[model samples]
Structures are given as structure tokens and as C-alpha cells.
Target: MSTTTSPSKHLLELQGVHTHIGAYHILHGVDLVVPRGELTLLLGRNGAGKTTTLRTIMGLWQASQGSLRFDGRDISRLHTPQIAGLNIAYVPENMGIFADLTVKENMLLAARQARTVAQIDEARLQWIFGLFPAVQKFWNHPAGKLSGGQKQMLAVSRAIVEPRQLLIIDEPSKGLAPVMINNMIDAFAQLKASGVTILLVEQNIHFAKRLGDSVAVMDNGRVVHAGRMAELAADEALQRSLLGLAL
Candidate 1:
């Protein structure tokens, strides 16, 4: 006889989470969930505490109160590096690429298991190149020299340099041309199909609706609505009420 264990339905969960930045309370009891192998979108207007929530989850900002659980373990008290060590990757709104370094060097730095370019897994690197051709095209070029869309691609490619259990991305499609945004949407769809859980803070309603399996709308530091993306996408009245615009 043999027995097997089952994985948790939710890969990441934040319950009643609160955060304060120098006496300014940000997250007001944020409750969000990222289901295993699904893409969850965090949507809201400016100053809605969307980025703050992502920062808190990544341990960049400590949650003053409440619980954050990752794969059934408490992570509210963990430090930034420690949280990242659990195979979680975060790409902030700024993209966070090393501008001074060559694209190849930046990628090499992201690969923890590889000390040199030659040591990186060839197959995986090729797969990333396929996902973002600009990263390959600018392999030896300084990251700062690339266009905005290229930089965003490089940032995402760097995050997936090694296998990640979860990806927390902030506005991957920001400041891009329509063509580039569509390209990004395609890349993200492929990434979702590859089985990594994703949490995104996106202002692009089209991108969010296209790729999100679940949706959470935040306002004034609180999550005002949470449900299936399709349900929200189909309901214009609810969208206007929660997001102040129809999707």
C-alpha cells in the first residue's frame, strides 16, 4: 500500500494584513489569495495601495498585523531575502534591471545556480529567449540602452531565469506600445501555462482581463472586491462601481 500528499489549493494567502510606512497606515486588512497554477490580478486606481500590498507580501514592508502564509507556512515575519529564497520572484513597477550591466550579465546575476554564463541551463535560457526575443537580441548590450519594452522583457526574463514557484509582478505592461503590450500578454499566457502561480498589480484593464484567472480590486488600502476574472469582466455595473470604469 502507498500514500501520497496533496498540495494546498492556494499557494499564497494574506489574511487581515495591515502595514504602516512611517506612521502612515497603508494596507487595511488586505485579504488576497493566489491559487496554485493560476494568475491573479490586483487592480485599482492610483494611491489605492496596490503596490504597498505587493511590497508587504514580498517582505519589503513588514506587515504590522495579520498573517501571510505561503504554501501553508507563516511568512509574515520573514525578511526580504528569506522570502525570495522560497523560490518566489518579485518584479516591481520600476522593473529593477541593472542598467549598467549587459543583458547577459544581468541574466547571469539572476541565475543563482550559475556562476558564469556558460553554467546557465541552456534549454531554459533558450526558452526565455523564445519568450522575449529582445533579451536575446541585446544579449551583450547594456541593459540601460534597451527601449522601455525591452527592459520590461529583460526584467521578466530575469525573474524566470531559474524555476520559480510564484511570480509577483507590478505592471508588466506599463509604458509600452500596443504591439509590445500584446507581446507581453502572449508571454504571460505562456508563463501561466507553464504552471507557476502569478500575482500582478496591473492598471491595464485589457491585459488583466485577458490573463487573470482571479481578480481583486483595491481601494483606499482595502480590497473592495474579489472574484473570478470572467465574472468581473462580464459585469460592467460591478466594474464601474468597484473600479470607477467599465472593463
Candidate 2:
């Protein structure tokens, strides 16, 4: 039940990418593909280099070898700001919220094009509010005061504060309750409907199964499996073999 997507249709591609952090080599010739306008899940067990892969894509970590392409253009040597300027937004697992800033201020800061809340697109703001009501609820509250789940929502809200070509999020469902996870799922569903390509690093299989259109499972810094989400979701043995857990 595996599925394949043409390279031309892929918004992001990595071929033989390798990353080293001082004395440690993280990504070992990793190859990954993310199709346009679909959610692709990057799944792996702990210490499998999932976060390292994301950081490499963001130019937060320079690849020592291999090529990285976005929209068919070479971006392997770009700096973080340059990479971000290409309309790719990244939300790290730490959530990256400014604790002392108000929720509205955080959103405003992420919107580089907008200097004021009034400058933000009214309709888009409303859409984001619909996606995560907590953002709207805590608009004036300090981000540090929010609960874990609420802060995660704010982080996502900040990333989407303005439109972008791609959204790379690390574990949006991490540390969330079942009810909160459902809310996060719904928000992502709406985001997908908006036709934005997403690359998510998720350890939550339930979250991945529910929203992932394509999946690439990593181990020891390389992609060991790639296919349609439904295919992996339907095969319990494949799940166990690749992820070391049943879906």
C-alpha cells in the first residue's frame, strides 16, 4: 500500500544530508521528501535525529555534506534568517514563546510584515482565532502565565500569524491531554485545508495517523521508511517494525 510522489511535486527535498555537532554526527545521509499542500510526518524514537533533521532544514544547523532544496532551488548554505525569509516557519519543540510578552505581542513579532495588530489581516486573524480560541482568550495575557497546552497553541498561532509557504512544527501534541490533543488536531486540519505544506516532527502516533498524508520514519539519522499514512496506519506489523510500537 505504499505510495510515491514525484520529485517535481515535492516542495522540499533533502538528499544525502549529513550534520555534525562538534564531536557528534547527527544526520547520516538523510533523504526526505515533502509533497506540496500536504502534511508529512517525521516520526522516530527518541535520539533518532528527528529534531536534528528539522534544524538542518531550517539552517539552524549547517549540513556538512549533501544538498537541500526548497521549491527546486538549492538552499543548503543559507542562514537561518535567509531560510525563514523564503516563507518557511519553524516551531521548535521548546515552543519558543517569549515569556514576558503578551500573546498579542508574540503574534505581532512573528508577523514581520506587520508592525501593529491593526496591520494584520483581519480575516486571517479571525481564522486563527477560530483555529485556537485560547490565543484570542489570552491575547492580552503574558505568555508565561499560560498552561503548557495553551502555550503550545500560542506558539502555533504565532507561526501562522501571517501566511507562509511551509510550516515545520516539532511535536505540537507533546505533553497535551487527550482533549487538548483533539483541539490541536482540529487546528491542524483547518491549516491543511488552507493549502499550506507542513512538515511535522511528531512522536505521537495518534496525531500522525490522524493528520499525516505522507510519512517518513527515521532511525539513526536516515529515512528508513516512506509512504502514504493510511498504508502504515493499516499495517500493525509495519508500525511495530519501523516505529517499535503498534499504531
Candidate 3:
């Protein structure tokens, strides 16, 4: 495990977050922080409540207790659009792309909402095309015509069009072919290098192992383990116990 410093340098802080989904209580005083300019992975088995945590951070679900702060501002009571206006982009597991829209059309719409997006628009499209060349090859193609992995890439690329301060992505690799999965990892690494703060929720341990810088493991709605991704990879016991993987 890597050595720890204090969390005072964090850009996003969630202190003792308590959230409920419908009648079900999910988060039990959850605490998390996303340091500025760093990639953080949220990992766990199914039903561990990682999705809810992301929603809470995005203000989709308000915490019954605790506070969420972004860049030293209290946002626990902010609306979803308010948080989004702050440049925190979220790509849900569904990819959320309009299937009928073409890649060019999607980028066009995104560009209209964000003017500075031009830089990211130029950089992100080029980078994504490089990461998954299929995108460039199919620029005018409708999103619905693409495969699962291609759709996933488009979703991420769509989010990156605006160059947000933070990106929270859920299950970017769900139902993807092995080749596409590898390609996605490379793309994520490129985004990190380009200065994107990422909070990713992933179930595929191998994918997380390849892309994650730091890993936080959640179980039963609470974080139970956190450390450098290297440490998580080396500890077979931790993997088997926390993730039920046959390490």
C-alpha cells in the first residue's frame, strides 16, 4: 500500500454521507474524497452501493446526512443541474447517448452548451478516434448502429466533449469484447494524462487493475478498503474477500 498524506488537498469531499434509495437505506455514513487532478476508482461486488454513491456526489440523490463539497464549496443541497453546471460530468452505465444521433451531431449539441468545449472538442475527438479508431471511421454513423463497446466509447467521448473538472463514469466496460475493453483502458489512461479527474465505478477487476491509480472497495454500502491500485492487485486475499474473485 502507498503511504498516506492528509486529505486536505482534495477537490471533492464527502463526509459521513447517508443516502436512502426509496425505502431502502443504502449508504451507512459513507465517507469519500476525490483529490484534485487524480483518478479514483470505486470498486466492489454487486449491491455494494457504488452507483448510489456516484449519484449522491452528482446530487441526483441527496444525502440524508453529511455534506458534499466541491472545490471548497458546500454542494450537499445543490440540484443535479447545478452540480453539472459546475463542470462535473457523469456518464451512467446506460451510456445515455441518443441512439438516433450521429457522432457529429452529438458533438455539435455538446459544443453548443459549452464554448470552451472547442479545445476539448478538438482534443477529445482526436484522442478518442486514436483510442478507438473505429469512431473516426464512423464519424457520421448513427450511434444506434454501433456495437456495445463502440457505444460505450461514444458515451465517454460525449462526456469528454466539454472538458469538465471531474468525470464520474459507471461500468464503461459492461458487456464489451476483450479487444474493446483493452482499448477502453488505453483511452482512460490518455484522459488522465490530459488532466481529467475521474471517479469510476467498475466491477471488472482486471479492467480496474489496468486503469486505476487508486482503488476504494465498498461492501454493503460502506467503504471497507482503499489504497494504491498496485496494492490491491498484489493482495490476493483482499481480492477474494472483498470482490469474491478467484485470485
Candidate 4:
């Protein structure tokens, strides 16, 4: 019999997942679900295993126990490149841009099918430029010269250089000014509207509340809360209990 589950609403699901990094346990039975075509927010305090969960999903860290399912297929044993080949894009917290490369070079590298700038899909490139003008403005400039927020935009732009089934991002708004955060929020909103499932590890409650359709809160290496983002946003007590602060 096949190990893969039947099709369901969730694009990604982690059940009883446990991960260890060289004798140190990071995730303890973390259960998370990213519903198809919705933005899911993974929220928690520091050292709450959020990053570990993302890494495990990407196969950067192996799971000691349990299963990871993506699109009804078991991906628990897949390699990182194999996982990425399934049209899932991951943008790490550090933004993962090549500082030495020009902005255009960074984007070209992400487009697996394109060998040159002229080969890249013009419409898609234009759409990305619309989402982040700085990308176009600094196309010839080295990625290292861009501002923090610009770099974050470039990272996300690179992730969507080609179409993707899911986008996994870690803290897109971290260290961004309020104006840049708002811009990022708007870009994400458009991305969501265009029908891409997103699983984001976010520290900004306001950003989470605004963009998240589903929310999962991790605590002590496990999911303590899972439900609609509106419910979590409206409940101050629950917010305090799960996140230690009001949203």
C-alpha cells in the first residue's frame, strides 16, 4: 500500500515530528498544517523550535521521528534539493542572497529554466518588479549594496522567480522600518491573492494578524495553538497565553 495520504486541504502537514541536532533535541512532536492557498503564520517566542521545524521540512535537519507530508506525499526522507525540486521555495531568515552578485545575477540564478536575462519570463519579472521597485532600480548594483528591506525584497523575488507551489519564509519583516514593513505587507497580500500557499515564521504580531489566514503558535517545541488568525487576533487573553503579548 502507498504511504502517501489521500488529497486533503492541507498542502503541508507535520505530525508528531521530532528533530535532533547532534544530541540536542529541537522539535518535540511538532504538529503543523499549512492549508492550501492560504497564508499560515508560525508564531512563537525565541528558541521555540520554529526555525527547526522549517529546517526539518526543508530536509536541512533530519527528523528523528514522525512524518512530513507535502501534497499528500511523504517527504520525510527526501534530500534538500529534492524537496526544493517539488516547486517549494524557502527563504531563510538571513535572506540567502548572494552579496557578491548583482541584483539581476541573483534573480537569474534562482530561475532554473533561464540561462540568460533575456530568457527569463518578461511578464513574471515585470510583476516582481511591480511588487518591489528597488529590485529594478538596483538591477545592476551588487546585492550587498542594497538596504536591508531591499535585500529582503530581492530574497522573496528570487524565490518567486519561477512559479512555486509553496513559499516558506522566515521573518520577512524583521528589522524593517514601519514604512518598509507596510510595503512588505502589501506585497505579500498581492502574492496571496495570486494563489500561492505561504508558510511564514513571523515575529511581528501586527504583520501576522493582517496577512495570516491560518495561525499556529509554537511553544517549547510543540504547537500550542492552531486555528484561524482572526480568532487569535481577537482574543487578547489567548494571545497573551500563547505569545506572551497581545496582538
| Model 2 agreement with the true structure over 1-247: per-residue lDDT tens digits | 9999655799999999999999999999999999999999999899999999999999999999999999988999999999999999999999999999999999999989899999999899999999999999999999999999999999999998889999999999999999999999999998999999999999888898899999999999899999999999999999999988898
Cα lDDT of all candidates, in order? 0.96, 0.95, 0.83, 0.96
In model 4, how large is the Cα lDDT of residue 195? 94
- Please write out the lDDT profile of model 4 over residues 1-247, one tens digit for every residue: 6696567999999999999999899899999999999999999999999999999999999999999999999999999999999999999999999999999999999999999999999999999999999999999999999999999999999999999999999999999999999999999999999999999999987799899999999999999999999999999999998888998
Best by the lDDT measure: 4
Mind giving the per-residue lDDT tens digits that candidate 1 earns over 55-170?
99999999999999999989999999999999999999999999999999999999999999999999999999999999999999999999999999999999999999999999
Q: In every candidate, how many clashes are there?
A: 0, 0, 0, 0
Candidate 1 vs candidate 4: which has greater lDDT?
4
Report model 4's TM-score to 2 decimal places: 0.97
lDDT of 3 by residue, 123-144 (tens): 6567667877876777889989
Rank candidates by TM-score, best first.
Answer: 1, 4, 2, 3
In angstroms, give how far residue 189 of model 2 lies from its true place: 0.7
Pitting candidate 2 against candidate 4, the one with the higher lDDT is 4
